[model samples]
Target: MKKISIIILLFSCFVYGQNKQLLYNFTDIPQSLLSNPGAEVNYKWHVGIPLLSHIHANAGASGTSVYDLFADNGIDFNEKLRRVVYSMNKNDFFTVNQQLEIFSGGFAIGPSYEKNKYLSFGLYQEMDLHLYFPKDYAVLAYEGNRDNIGRVFDLSDLNAKGELISVLHVGLTTKLNKKWTYGFRGKIYSSLLNFKSTNNKGSFVTQEGTNNFYYHTFDLDLAFQTSGFASLVDLENEGQNDWNGKAIKELRKRVLFGGNLGLGLDVGFTYHPKEQWTVTGSIQDLGFIHHTKDVETYTLKGEYTFEGVNPLFPNNGSGQTADEYWQEIEDTFDDLFELDTITKNYTSWRSPKLNGSVSYKYGKKVLKECNCTAEDGDYLNEVGLQIYAIGRPRRPQTAVTAFYYRRLFSFLSGKVTYTADTFSKTNIGLGISSHIGNVNFYIMADNLLEYQNLAKANYASVQLGFNYIFPATKK
Candidate 1:
């Protein structure tokens, strides 16, 4: 559940990251990415069930800023194993951060309910488990006093099991007026995010290896919004819950408060000279939020220096035994260099975007166009073409502009009937939508690239949803 929730969150971010292609194409529909469920409205509710599968890999490099630190201080020196010792003296030792490339894949599938142009509500159960992860390492080696040509090691080769997490979400939205809308939602999540390495002691021998431990944690969420969608603040995982089942010598308890808030404005106007052509534009996700907070924890690594020993072994000559030497070494090391607990905290600030679109429709696909011959229902079909542009803040060169065309087939199934939009890039998708007697159903798929490309984080995704539209029939 937690895994699926995470995937949904990632998908939302990737799609609506900054009003690019999928959800918010600056099409006049107010969209919310933080909550899985949407709000209610007057138009047909767009219910979506989306399933996403992909593999994400780190493609950057680990630099030298960290290597220089390990060399300057023998404290974190990689004595025998060519790896630096961490957690020995937390506050003093330099912290190293690096990037890597690895094969990691997972999938998420669930139902989503949403009402378009009126109000929207949503709920979904999802899970995206990771079968593999990148191999990262921090090496510390010194040669001939000055010229230290460190040897690169692949730490990812160590054996580790896959992890599965899950999440559930529910949301609601309502329109206060023509220009103002409001929404709220709550989420519950749990992560079985635990794993162990295959090397056993060989991997756990040093700080670099010992750092491969896993833990399970759960989080919470609280959010609300007002029309015009000026800004929103999300509060998540404020603290840990009570756990009395585990039998540990020491059960320490800690509390934390964290999440992100956005502050911005969305202003757009549609221009339709012939009523058949509509153009819209808006700047989206213009503000930044902290995705994660810096964390500080203990990462200890060190060795024992023997003292009392036999004559052949040296230290205490033939008079002392191994126990005496071991005890002496332990006492000396403990007194000379004490252990330190580290606490780290950092924040991730994402980029914003600017988007716009021009769409042209050939017919009226509304309630007035009941051209269906069926005596029981109304169906409207129309053809549409749209040219859209999307740009990111940091990397403008990667900006993408696409042209889309959608063909509405029929509404005989009790709702809107439309096929997925096909872009000029030759990417094809399917769309199934319907709204009958206040019940709405919608499904849309994007990208649809090959399965192998999906793992590369370079493919398309599919979304299907169902929503019940309850208009304020009475006062």
Candidate 2:
């Protein structure tokens, strides 16, 4: 009974390629190369499950979990929300990313698999959204500036990024000798829509005034940029009532090669100094996109101060009335916030990620005298620690995972992980791969402890795929 329970616990699968600690260097799955281009795999050729080849979704909040505000602890809901907001700082953030493969395949080259090169190619669509916690903005909206006198709200706190894109990629890996293997992947990216608003500077403040009233000050500079959404704006301007099919048409035009495009490169290597020890490292998405079509940038700059609104009754005909006074105030604000719009080409760099791990193998699997299976030369168990980092606007996001991998049979294998990162202190993950005949099916998941009751989870992710692997045939 205890052994069965352990099996069930280690079988809930998940992947975080964005930091995919489970999938990195996990050589059994061909798609593992997405996380580490230089990954090691034993297949001579393979075909993916078309659209079902790979499916991944991840979302996490660093500030707090959902249960913190929605718990059934008999506390006031609003009070709970307030506590959550207060407990968090501006550096905290929420992020989400999802990917789906359209198609993928790979094949080995040369005389023999062990002494040659392998090539893999595929296409996938992905979307990502990232945002930092705006504590000052929340306070301003919740209590208004009236309650917090002389407080400054920094406009720079508003940092965010979002994008939807499709990537076409091809990779090649070669073994130079028994001790070294290297690989690299080339990618072309097509973006359907994207937006960024990370660079900003200014402050909003409410202070006691000299005119026997409160003074609201706005010394502001802000900018927002977007690409590939010009058609929607035109639809609204044209007053078109029917937007169903037309919207889809616009999307189709951009999702293909007609959209904003970019290039990326991924490279890595695997090394073994001793028979039982291995080390691997890789960098992914070192590239940028050019946004030239349907591009727009909006900027708000300059300064303005308001003591208060005034009611005016002019005795002279040249002066504004109470309503005109309001109009005059409106005009002042209009000039103060005169917006500048531009349509110019800009380059946006893809956020690059880093992965590295060191592992040692032991407990050789009991095998037949003559080696005939793929698992023959492999060990029964492995233990290792991996590190992951990704570049961000404000800083780099990082995590460390320690894992244990076991191969109970030639057809079934699994890995269990314990991770610590900005998202949570205690995150447990599991991944399983099964090979029956030439077909392979894999699934991985993490944070199962919190998954028991999702509201308590600050992070959640899952990855799964199917493929057909063929044995290497020597020339």
Candidate 3:
């Protein structure tokens, strides 16, 4: 159990905001297409530089931080653990997400005279995880019910979901007159692995009994389902041996549409209410996958009452062997409470995300003075507010951010943002994009204030990428 907790903590460190609000409208980089297909593109063509194209990792925890557990201040480790567990609520959760662009490129497909139509395509891999705090179960397992005799442990506290998938997508963006631009993307998802164990019900209670000093009752209905994982574990020697590299090889082969497949769609639109004001919205990953291969499920459902086991001596036998007595007790316990493991196919859905923003440019006249075309509404300075939401098992999580963008020079631009979300309210982020003769470089980070004392931070994220772009010919 301690090992499991450590693993969870380590994973949580890799988690927060998938929104990337600061980079949303930054049209200098081609990777912004993934977030909003309708985002304006000023370049004629762009290509991501191999593996260094786009790499993003974000993680967040709502309840505690690494400093809460590992900070050495002469306090007992067990006492610290107890304090951390008790301080957390049942709804607290840890989330982690990562995305890497394997290969990507885009180009204008229409005639040279007509620059309104463009096509973009890419293949990327992503992993997402969400684990809720199991407060009742943790207390019951860690401290036991001996201290609190009447406390009841609720099974609903166990809720978690995780998935790893690769996405191949193609998108088309076109201008629909002078005020509106729309885009659509079609995605093919190849699921590498998945796990889900929500929707549980029941409880465990210990109280005074009529005949025995204490009585225990357990009514549990639980099911844990997983796919593409069991076959990777070698149980020949009771799971003591490592996998023989066959599963990883198979997974690698399936990265290109060979695994469990699914379809998704992204739709977005940009509306220009006025010359200086614009509104943009997008919805992504509206799809599901059917897991039909290498699936495993475990279920436990029963109601049992224990009033202390009573030993019986048989008259026919001179003396009951220790193994026989223990075997009899185990068999009786199995009869009272049963657990079943089965293999069956299942279906899972991708978490749908929504993003919307409104921005107003203020220094457009300055661009004209600097000999900038400003045809695509590129402004020298702008401020905007962005809202983001994603659907989860329990509820939808939401975040909001206010950002300021500045085009410092012809080749350099930057953005600053302040965000409020489930993790923290004082999240300040910065993003910078630079073009050195058509070679584009961009990087962004969140929670800048916590970098000095990272252990006290509940959330942190950074994204960096490089791309090669060809400028549009001067008219």
Choose 1 or 2, whichever is better by lDDT: 2
lDDT values of the candidates?
0.29, 0.81, 0.82
Q: How far in Å is the alpha carbon of 464 misplaced in model 2?
A: 0.5
Specify the highest-TM-score model's number.
Answer: 3
lDDT of 2 at 246: 73
Most lDDT-accurate candidate: 3
lDDT of 1 at 316: 48
Report the C-alpha lDDT of model 3 over 329-445, residue by residue, as the tens digit. Answer: 677678645667789888888888898999998875345476865665556898999999988888888889999999888889999999998888998999999999999999999
Q: TM-scores of the models, in the given order?
A: 0.37, 0.88, 0.90
Native RMSD of candidate 3 (Å): 3.7
lDDT for each residue of candidate 1 in 1-475, tens digit (9 for 90 to 100): 5685354224222221111244333111222222112222233333332321111111111111122223344554335113322222111111111111111111111223422223232222222211111222222221321222222333333222221122223334444343334444333222222122222111212222122332111111111111111111121333333222221111111100112222222233334445455454444323322222222222233433232332335454566666776667667667434534433332222222344445554433444457534433322332333233322211231224344433344332211212122111334434344545555454444444432343322224444333343333322
Q: Sorted on TM-score, highest at the top, how do the candidates line up?
A: 3, 2, 1
The Cα error of candidate 3 at residue 10, in Å, is: 3.0
Tens-digit lDDT string for candidate 2 (164-215): 8889999998877767888999999998888888898898998999874788
